[model samples]
Target: MNYPKFRKSAELFGVICGGLLISMPAIPQAVAQESTPKINPCPRIFYEEPHNNQVVVPQGCPPNALTQRLAAQGLLPVPATPSQEQTNLGVGGETPQPSVKLPRPASGDQTQQPSPGAVSSDQPPLLQPRQTPSATIALANGTVNIKLVNDTATNVTFQVIGDTAPRSLAGKSDVTLQGLKAPVTVTFEREDGGQLIVTPQASSEPGNLNVTFNEATNAAQGRSAMRVEPNGSVFLN
Candidate 1:
């Protein structure tokens, strides 16, 4: 064998191997760079408004004419694009909007039935019956006997004009003034400068007068006088 010739062939083989190694690394690096995804430094900024609407904008990004036109027309913050994952989720690439389901009537025919004791819609409502009035019987002519009852919280003084002297009846007390003439006048005043109310309770008995004096708070309702008429009719003033 020629030794010098073999040495020259071996040197050429080593040079080819070194070139292949350097070229192989460059191919892998180019492929890796092409496979890497590019990311935008300025993604959309999202913020909530006072009305709970989301406002989206590319705040620090380059301005686009379409985005500026929509914003000028008061139609800013358009809906976000559905992502690739959401598109492939079998929802037909549409985001489902929120919905509210109201309660329906129980009837299968879609018409609500009237509840128990409820008035029918087609029928007229029943009215209350008219009350029958009682007959008023006239009293016979006689001397009137007056009974005064004080159902109050304070002491009251009353005077029957020309029949009995002025008398003071305590709280929750009663007094009888006998044989008062027709057209009897009685005046009452409270010891505490409060108010007094006089009401005639009964004249059912012949020649008998039954009256009650009650305390009152309203100035319009506080009356001071009671008059017994000749025919047993009563009046308060």
Candidate 2:
């Protein structure tokens, strides 16, 4: 064969072998599959107290041999056992006391203890019954003063005075009834009063302040109003 022909044949053979090697499937890389770490469910043994004969076990011990032994000897609370969910969550397992032993009084002692159900009359009466506040409305300088009958430590809150009223007032003292062109209704709340004080604002304009007092919601037993006279005397009644 000619030299050029021989060289071409050799190159063709090499290409075929290379293609076969490239097409072959590859071997998988080796990897170590890790197992999940195991958690020890048992309680630590180091908590055993030899002096008190107490044992602290892992949280979820059943009411079996160990618990029964501790209870029988009065080392643990009687009838106290861990719930199933608590056991699953891992809580509870400590023996605190062996038992409570009550000592008897001396034989010749002439003292008597009151029965458990007895109450002593000498004890001071409970703090005076809380008094309910009476409600009254006082108006000054575009501000309204809701005087409660009783002194309350709590802050007073108020709502606009109608069944369709919105929440508009809340303060420690003296709520400002704003946006008043004519008259508006107001409801007062006392910290101790069961009733609400419902009164209509005396309108500067005729038919402007037409409001009804809801006795059910009125903390004040009576209907009251605040008005400013030309003499500058403010009548709050």
Best by lDDT: 1
Window of ten residues with lowest summed lDDT in model 2: 25-34
lDDT (10s digit) by residue, model 1, range 1-237: 899999999999999999998899899899999999545433333222321233334544333455555766877664355445544331322344558888876678687668999888899878998533211223445566678888998889999887668889899999887776677788998898898877776667766667788888789989888776665566677
lDDT of 2 by residue, 1-237 (tens): 599999999999999999888766432212222343334343434223451234444344444455566778997665445555445444223333457887777877747767789877777867986433222233344443322221233434445454335432332233334444213444445434444334444345432332333333433464344343322233334
Pairs of residues clashing in candidate 2: 43-58, 133-150, 134-149, 161-185, 195-218, 195-219, 196-217, 196-218, 196-219, 197-219
The TM-score of candidate 2 is 0.19
Query: What's the TM for model 1?
Result: 0.40
What C-alpha lDDT do the candidate models reach, one value each?
A: 0.68, 0.44
Best by TM-score: 1
Residue-level lDDT for 72 in candidate 1 = 68
What TM-scores do the predictions have? 0.40, 0.19
How many pairs of residues collide in each model? 0, 10
